[model samples]
Target: MDTTHRKKNEQNNHPRKGITEFDSNRATLRGKNIFPPFYVKTTVPLQEALKNGEVRNNTHLLVIERNAQILALLTQQMNYHHVAQGEIAGEPWMVSL
Candidate 1:
């Protein structure tokens, strides 16, 4: 019997047939809730951010400019969130780090 067919039959007979098998070699985590994407709901002005100590002179930023409008996000914040989304120039935009 073919190995692929044998494996398929084995999976079908298993109780967790519908669930995906984990592959450590490839580091696949199909069902794991790791690194969920973050959504940006609101934004603060640069002055307010500065006043709140959210931004510093040396803080790195990811900036996007479109249709004369600009959007900026802190790199440190993005590092943990992994993904962020916002609107720019009336269009939807997404950024991933």
Candidate 2:
């Protein structure tokens, strides 16, 4: 994932009120989390939820990767916004909302 846009937004200290489709792909959902393995496997639908006002701050969504048995929870962080990058075995990726 490219941090160019994330960094730019971070510099301005702007909180994303809604997630556009363009930004949906950034979530990088794994296929196993979705209904079927052949599905889009993208968080775009979740982004649409935010865009459509279906969720609010402090709202968290959990995704379970059946294959890997990994649990991913996505939530927005009102403060301390920063993306910590790195991968650890058996550890799921965590991003601020």
Candidate 3:
């Protein structure tokens, strides 16, 4: 059988399936408790969180919510800046999407 067929069989027979090799490492990280939920905010500025020690440079995900809906997922490498007045400023960069 082809790889797709094999994967489908695995999904039918196993409780956990559709997990690609790349997801395996992320699973390990979760299993080992290596990563924790980073800062989550809506109106609260990320820079304020950083200055208040609620977030660090290694913070990967910024869960932003607006009007009870998730506005965006600010992933790692997302360009951002903190102003002198402790304001977070920046827009998500588009890469030929």
Query: Where does candidate 3 clash, by residue pair?
Result: none
lDDT: the better of candidates 2 and 3 = 2
**How are the candidates ranked when ordered by TM-score, highest leading?**
1, 3, 2
Poorest 10 consecutive residues by lDDT, candidate 3: 80-89
lDDT of 1 at 54: 87
lDDT of 2 at 82: 31
Tens digits of lDDT, candidate 3, 1-97: 9999999888799955555556555443434423333332334456776799876778776444333443333454233321111112343322210
In candidate 2, how many Å is residue 18 off? 58
Please identify which of the two predictions, 1 or 2, would achieve the higher lDDT against the true structure. Answer: 1
Better of 1 and 2 by TM-score: 1
Candidate 1 local lDDT, 1-97, one digit each (tens):
9999999899889975676777577666588557777677788887888889989878899987767877788988888888888676577888888
lDDT of 2 by residue, 8-75 (tens): 77767756545454766567867553321121233445566678887655586545454354434443
Q: Any idea how many clashes model 1 has?
A: 0
The collision pairs in model 1 are none
Q: Pick the candidate with the highest lDDT.
A: 1
What TM-score would you give candidate 2 relative to the actual structure?
Answer: 0.22
Instruction: Compare the candidates by TM-score and give the number of the best one.
Output: 1
How many collisions per candidate?
0, 1, 0
The TM-score of candidate 1 is 0.62
Q: Which stretches of candidate 2 lie over 4 Å from their true place?
A: 1-44, 67-97
Q: What is the TM-score of each candidate against the true structure?
A: 0.62, 0.22, 0.25
